[model samples]
Target: MNVTGWQRDALLAVAEVVVLAVILVMALLGNGLVLVVLLRRRRHHNPLHLFMLNLCLADLVVALFQVLPQLVWDAKGRFPGPDFLCRLVKYLQVLGMFASSYMIVAMTVDRHYAICCPLQAHRSGATQRWNTFILLAWGLSLLLSLPQVFIFSRSEVAPGVYECWGNFAESWGLKAYVTWMTLAVFILPVVIITVCQPGPAASSAFCCPLPKAPTARGGEVSAAMSKTVRMTLVIVLVYSLCWAPFFSVQLWAAWDPDPPQNGAVFTLLMLLASLNSCTNPWIYSAFSSIQLYGKLINILCLVCLIQTLYFILYM
Candidate 1:
């Protein structure tokens, strides 16, 4: 059977919408659960837990602002709203990307400081320092995303047809913008995470050592620190894996005159980038205590079951 071009495009659009919808639901459920568990805990003051909370918030932003809006745009086949909405959505989409990337960097750097500079980690005003890091991560994200507001607007791309579009300079503008975004959002953060992560031996020695004392408290602390380090590493690894291809594709499309914009492989890779938001909560839950993991598994299963039924009936 031969499929027409329009039919193929329709299939692609449907696939994209389904993928985004799944990503949005998983991100909301997983991160929402993580947020609730963190908030309910008496030890919410723990620096690692606080960072995880912020990370979940960042993932929620991605789900709500980035994935959700894109899903709508895909379904409608155009941007649907006023000029203000167009700009606002563009701003938030980039903001989510920045926040998610930097939050992980901040978390990794904190762990590095704790393991490499134990004295500084335990010094007075540690809580304030951690708060400062969190504030800086979000502050930078907000500040950096301002460009989206000015660059993107509801524009008349065709006669009597308007869509949310970016205004870039004729020749060099798009290339420059994409290059800068790739650097700011992905490249630089990966460099920081790489530098901050210690080797396995060093991490093991700093985070967990052979039991010198028979006390359970000492063992518990060692185990907790080790788990925290491992968890942070996993999150960073997953983030890099998920986003690297997206940024690479963006760069390629921007620089190459005849890029593979319609390539299925490229499109799928870009779509899968948003899966990072969905994976963070699960990674944290897996590393957490058995009680926490059990709680999350139950809710996660329920959400999946409900979503499955909804898709079968409606989608």
Candidate 2:
């Protein structure tokens, strides 16, 4: 069947909304499950699990406030709320992104110290200190996102169609801001994670199989630490791949304000970036045990179904 340009555009818009909605659902459910399971488990107060909880919380913030507003704007073609609400939404969204990135970095650093420098890790990573790390991560994220409060404003895109947009005074300012954000939130964190990854011998510090077994302590600890290193490395890889396109496009838009229109492509890129929030839980599940691996595989199959449907109907 053939479709006209308008029809095709309408389909694409619908696909964007549906895809974003699916992402929100998956992110909420998967991260919520992580929170719930960790909270209900007997060892919930441990530093490592608490750090995972922080990551889940950050992903939830992105799903609920960040992606949800974008989804609404895409579906409605305008900001549905007042100027103040728009500013708040934009601020929260950026804060969530910063928080998620920093949370991952903190996780990497914590593991690196724990595995590579046991005595130092024991001294520096006490319960109070871990609390301070969590606090500092959230505090710095909010502080860094403060500029969004001043930079975003509700602007009229068409006659009576208001949308939230950057209110930078100059093009250079916008470019600089986006460049800094890209570096701080994406590039620098990935580099830090890469550098902090433990080598094979360091893995022996904290190895244990995901499943409980009466195995030799040394071998188990080595295997577990190796898996942990692999898992975090994979996370950083996925995060970079998912976010690079969106940041690249941002830099391009900053360079050329009147860039050529490719709305569908932009939507696809945004969807890929949002998928990062939905992936961490699945990554954890994959490295955990056979049971979780099976369940995560099923979830992945469903996600593939949704992506296929969107491409078939809209592209």
Candidate 3:
């Protein structure tokens, strides 16, 4: 390649590294704080809080397994680990994605049950039901992500150079894999979330009729439940917005003969999909108490200010 081409490639790598670094830090800090706070409060009995805790845990896994490894790969210009590490990382990366996606779906389904079927939701053993949902979410994620271990491995791409890559059948393997991932990870979960999110104006034609609260205390309970439902809805919307471009690009690159694999826009979209992890904690904070929201805002401002100063001084 020419000097200009080499320079552009180096610049893009640097940009990717910087972006991933920022995402990794934000995701870690945001999710870590949420986890700590929730655990300290010892509110696992609240099914919503239990889901939030697991969601944060899943986001942390994405930061560590998915984004961190990608950052390292970008900085090094290749995978810098053994075949085992490569396979493990790939499995955990997809595992985190699946866990995060299905956790949201499970949470939404819980809300749907509470709002639409109050009698069942308030029945005995509801906690057991929630626990079952959480277990299924994690179990399915583990099962689905096992394919990554078989698919990705360290391989010699050149005479002397090795990198982590996927082994696919010659003709249709990649296309099928990407399509299945998009369907399982993105499309199906989105459809489930959309159907579960009850509208404010519940018509019999669309959502199940919402039950009325019987007393003032029950009204307050309903309001709190509504807040959580709203929070879950925002999470679902943000997840879709952030991940749609990523899966779309993956599908296009898999199927299109002349895909824009090196296009700046597509690359940026994929990288910024990690921003969903960063935004999730803030979304939860926003829907939480005012005091918690204030604290989170302070933390976020401090992070942003530090990042800005570092860029100004070093970049």
Question: Top model by TM-score, which number?
Answer: 3
lDDT of 1 by residue, 1-315 (tens): 346767877888899999999999889988988898888884646898899899999999999999999999999999999999999999999999999999999999888877666655677467987888999999999999999999999999999999999998678899999999999999999988987886766566555343343655867876887888889889988998999999899999999999988766878788888999999989988887525457767877999999999999999
TM-score of each: 0.88, 0.82, 0.90
Which window of 10 residues has the lowest lDDT sum in candidate 2?
204-213
Candidate 1 stretches with Cα past 4 Å from truth are 1-3, 42-44, 200-219, 290-315
Top-lDDT candidate index: 1
Off by over 4 Å in 2: 1-5, 42-45, 200-216, 289-315
Q: Relative to the unseen true structure, what is the C-alpha lDDT of residue 261 in candidate 2, on a scale of 0 to 100? A: 49
Clashing pairs in 2: 207-220, 207-221
Each model's lDDT: 0.88, 0.81, 0.87
> What tens-digit string does per-residue lDDT give for candidate 3 at 1-315?
699888887888898999999999889988988888888877544887788889999999899999999999999999999999999999999998999999999998887877777776667468888898899999999999999998999998999999999999678999999999999999999998887787754324454455655675887886898788789889998999999999989988998899977767778888867888888888988898524556667888999999999999999
In each prediction, how many residue pairs overlap at the backbone (N, C-alpha, C within less than 3 A)? 0, 2, 0
Error of 3 at 141 (Å): 0.5
* Regions of model 3 farther than 4 Å from truth: 200-213, 290-315
The lDDT-based order of candidates, best leading, equals 1, 3, 2
Give the Å shift of residue 15 in candidate 1.
Answer: 0.3
Predicted candidate 2 versus true structure: per-residue lDDT over 65-90, tens digit per residue:
99899899889967888889988998
